[model samples]
Target: DAGVTQSPTHLIKTRGQQVTLRCSPISGHKSVSWYQQVLGQGPQFIFQYYEKEERGRGNFPDRFSARQFPNYSSELNVNALLLGDSALYLCASSPTAVYGYTFGSGTRLTVV
Candidate 1:
């Protein structure tokens, strides 16, 4: 009955480096989604995984990737990080087979 959980609540990275964020969905949830939120902007959908397969992705570059584990947990990875990549990386879960989500507090990422 727990809500979605994200790891490493905060992170600091340098430009050109890489970063990975983790998430664990709520119990009984089979769908997970990732989103990015800049300080003053709305959350942007990044990826959605349902039944361990990717079902949706946003406008992010190829450097952004993700995978869902057999346990339904998920990871989000970004390569060649850029200053603009600094933001809150959020994880959401839904019982919906398709879209609509409820997000976690997120792992705040800072790129210098």
Candidate 2:
């Protein structure tokens, strides 16, 4: 079975531009969560969606948003990107809340 996967692996953006990052969850999984990890820091939760419904969200700005599709894939959209927005965006999935999460390598966003 394929694990969670993210696209691009790396990204470059300018201030005020928008970027969309994609993620594919593991097979048979229904829960997908987004997290942002700054350099030298742990991944911080951004959003969580289960059954295509918003389950949880972290303390991030409105510029950061995401949605999970019917196919269990997800996309994170960030608008008005700032230099501070530059970070590794990780996607994690789990069979259920009781299970541990498996994370993707991440899309490294560099906002200049």
Candidate 3:
């Protein structure tokens, strides 16, 4: 049973570019969530998916979007990247919508 896995452990992008982050949840996990952790701040919830549907969304802008697959894997898309968007994007998963969420190491995105 692997925990949530995020891809491109690190990324470098320029302003106005777009980026896509990937995540694969643990086996048998139906729920996946995304968070953004800025330096010196907590991880901010970005999106939550259950059964391939968007269940909850954070206060991010419209440029942020995500989708879950039949296998419970998910992808986070960020359009029109900005320097402020640089952060460690994390993926979390759990058996249910409750506690027990296991998080990934995160994808550190740096914008220049």
Candidate 4:
């Protein structure tokens, strides 16, 4: 069973530019969540979607948004990216009815 996977292990962007990160969940899973991890900090939840419907969201600004597809894959979109937005974007997923979560290595975004 393949675990969660994220693309563009590293990225470089300028302030005000937009970026899109991708994720694919494990087989048979139905929930995908996006989190942002700044340097020296834990992952901050951005959004959670189950069965293509948003189940929860964190305190992130509107610039941070995400969506899950029918195949259980997901994409996180950040608009007007700032230097503070430069961080590790993590993708986590779990079974539709499970508790523990599995996280991807993440896309490291560096906004200059």
TM-score per candidate: 0.95, 0.97, 0.97, 0.96
**RMSD after CA superposition, every candidate:** 1.1, 0.8, 0.7, 1.0
Question: Which regions of candidate 2 are displaced past 4 Å?
Answer: none
**Predictions ranked by TM-score, top down?**
3, 2, 4, 1
Off by over 4 Å in 4: none
Candidate 2, 97: how far from true, in Å? Answer: 3.3
Task: Give the winner by lDDT: 1 or 4.
Answer: 1
Highest-scoring model, lDDT: 3
Model 1 residue 96 lDDT score:
76
What shift in Å separates residue 110 of candidate 1 from its native position after superposition? 0.2
Q: Give the per-residue lDDT digits (tens) of candidate 2, residues 31-91.
A: 9999999999999999999988889999999998899899999999999999999999999
The best-first sequence of candidates by lDDT reads 3, 2, 1, 4
Per-residue lDDT of model 1, residues 1-112, tens digit only: 6788999899899999999999999887889999999999999999999999999999999999999999999999999999999999999998775656778899999999
Residue-by-residue lDDT tens digits, candidate 4, 8-101:
8999999999999999998888999888999999999889999998999899899888888879899999999999999999999998634768
lDDT value for model 1: 0.92
Q: List the residue pairs that clash in candidate 2.
A: none
Residue pairs clashing in model 4 are: none
lDDT of 4 at 34: 89
Which lDDT value does model 4 have at 8?
88
